[model samples]
Target: MANQASIETRDVRLWYGEFQALKGIDLDVSRGRITGLIGPSGCGKTTLLRCFNRINERYDYVRTEGSLIIDGHNIYAPDVDLIELRKRVGMVFQRPNPLPISIRDNVLYGYRLHTPKAERSRGAEDEALESALKSVQLWDILKDRLGDRATRLQLEQQQKLCIARLLPLKPSIILMDEPCSALDPDATAKVEELIRQIAGEFTILIVTHNMAQARRVSDECVFMLIGEIVEHGRTEDLFIAPKDQRTADYIEGRFG
Candidate 1:
């Protein structure tokens, strides 16, 4: 229960055309915790994150191997449904990409898409919208402005809205790819706090280039290099006493 893995990868490998992006990754992400993936550019951290929801398969030349299991299901199995998988494993990108529609519409878009028509009454939709916005601490500020265009909101508000939009789908896992990278220092701190507050309710896997951020937000950390994992351990231990020299060197700023 408490210690079980929500996401597990066994010797997972991936390639984009002739280029290998991931090479034999084996990892387990604990349920109801924050696991951060940190490494230099081109380290395949983001590639690995996208694998959880099978988004990387969008490219025609992209190919993957091995098993990626979420809960007890093998996501790469031929019978797996991509839409349902995505709904269960939501993603928040580096930049805020809210829709150009009204704020209320943006928050309810995913709900409307996945929910049955009979269950999408206006009162139900409004309730879902408020709950989602409150989860992201946006309800207070945006409650009266539901009809405003979402894209016109401040970057921080838009980013929070993007996360709010995912809640109505009732995802069990949340994947964040440098979610705070586009925000200012103040905004980044706020979003990091928000992530920490939501950790116990959903499994979170975040890809970050900022070592400091990894130290700050993650309960566990995985360090990767050139498509291969170098070290995986508790964040405090890994930062204080990394067993591998490459991990130590990278953390010490000796090399990227």
Candidate 2:
């Protein structure tokens, strides 16, 4: 049976002032699967990803139209609590961005935010920190250094920490935008492995410029061009036999 959609967009359009970045996109990202959004830099892959948690509206001039639904709720509805929405839909950026704090603090940041002070005791925080770190495969390596500064860790570990930090929030969907772009080849491979390890536990929608990464890490793929989705399908089907000529050309490196 097909997986239910974790995120669904219907005729979703976005604008930064007057410039349309996303033009009436209709897409579905399946629950507990990795979905890759691929396109050139100027395409709307990142824009569409940001719409999930309404992060695009952070820019004062940004505007959006149509429905962006996540887990059966329309995220754009006025009654929607942005904080709660963000808790359910966490995001990781292009580069590893750990805060200037201790490793334990970083991991517990989101948990602390959503949790009340009286309910958040040392024991609970410790358990959450350990669990989150272990989920991202960082516990063994960083357990002894919980008090160490997060920014001082290796890039790979830092990136993992960024991911680890999200787990405590119990997110339903994780949005990653070029998550490994800042890492070296070896680090990239390791991060990809980590991403694969965490799949099926959370719905992940990743935007990547690396076609190979998309193929390796994603179960499904989306191809966009000029602010439109050209094609979307199972990863193997899309890569092996793209239905759209534009998708084929781009995949074959004929053009972006």
Candidate 3:
């Protein structure tokens, strides 16, 4: 069954300085399901993804003119609280960025930003941190080495930890921008498994160049072209029986 709408963009448009990046895209990402955003380079997939969490709001002359709604709240509104929206719509970047602190401190960093630790009891923060790590299958590996520097871990492990850090806040949706682009096959498989395991708990929207990775992880897929979505449907039909020639061409490796 098609899941509930987790995020919806209506005629969304974005521009940087004088150049337009996203050209009035209208897309819906369903809750509790993985949605893939695939297109050629510079097709605005990442720009469109950044809009969900208001990440583009910081860019000068990056004006947007359409409604971008998350959980019934219009994020583009001037009155919208960006901090709250960002906390709810956490993002994982392509590269894993662990802070220059200990492993335990890295997980606690975002928590400190969102909540007060001193006001809470002794075990509350650590409990939440551990729970998040366990959810991402990193607790076992890092438990004994919590005092170690985050930069010391393997690249893949650090990436998973970056994801683990977000879980402490209990985000309703996750925005992943080519999160597995830098990982090897083994690491990518592990992250994919983690995504599958956590899907029903939180809505996930990913932008990727890897068609197979999208096919493997996403329940629904959107194929974009030149800043416009050409097709979107259940992954099986979209891949097996694409409606558009462009989609077929991209899927069949005839062209990107």
Best by lDDT: 1
Against the true structure, what is each candidate's TM-score?
Answer: 0.99, 0.98, 0.96
Residue lDDT tens for model 2, 135-177: 8889999999899999999999999999999999999999999
> Per-residue lDDT tens digits of candidate 3, residues 115-217?
8656665488789878988998888888998999999899889988989989878899999999999999999999989888989889999999999999999
- lDDT score of residue 41 within candidate 1: 98
Across residues 134-155, which tens digit of lDDT does each residue of candidate 1 receive?
9999999999999999999999
TM-score of 3: 0.96
Let me know the TM-score candidate 2 reaches against the reference structure. 0.98
Model 3 backbone overlap count: 0
Q: Give lDDT: candidate 1, residue 21.
A: 96
- Rank ordering of all candidates by TM-score, starting from the highest: 1, 2, 3
Task: State the displacement of the C-alpha of residue 155, model 1, in Å, after optimal TM-score superposition.
Answer: 0.8
Question: Candidates' lDDT values, in order?
Answer: 0.95, 0.94, 0.88
Number of the candidate with higher lDDT, 2 or 3: 2
Clashing pairs in 1: none
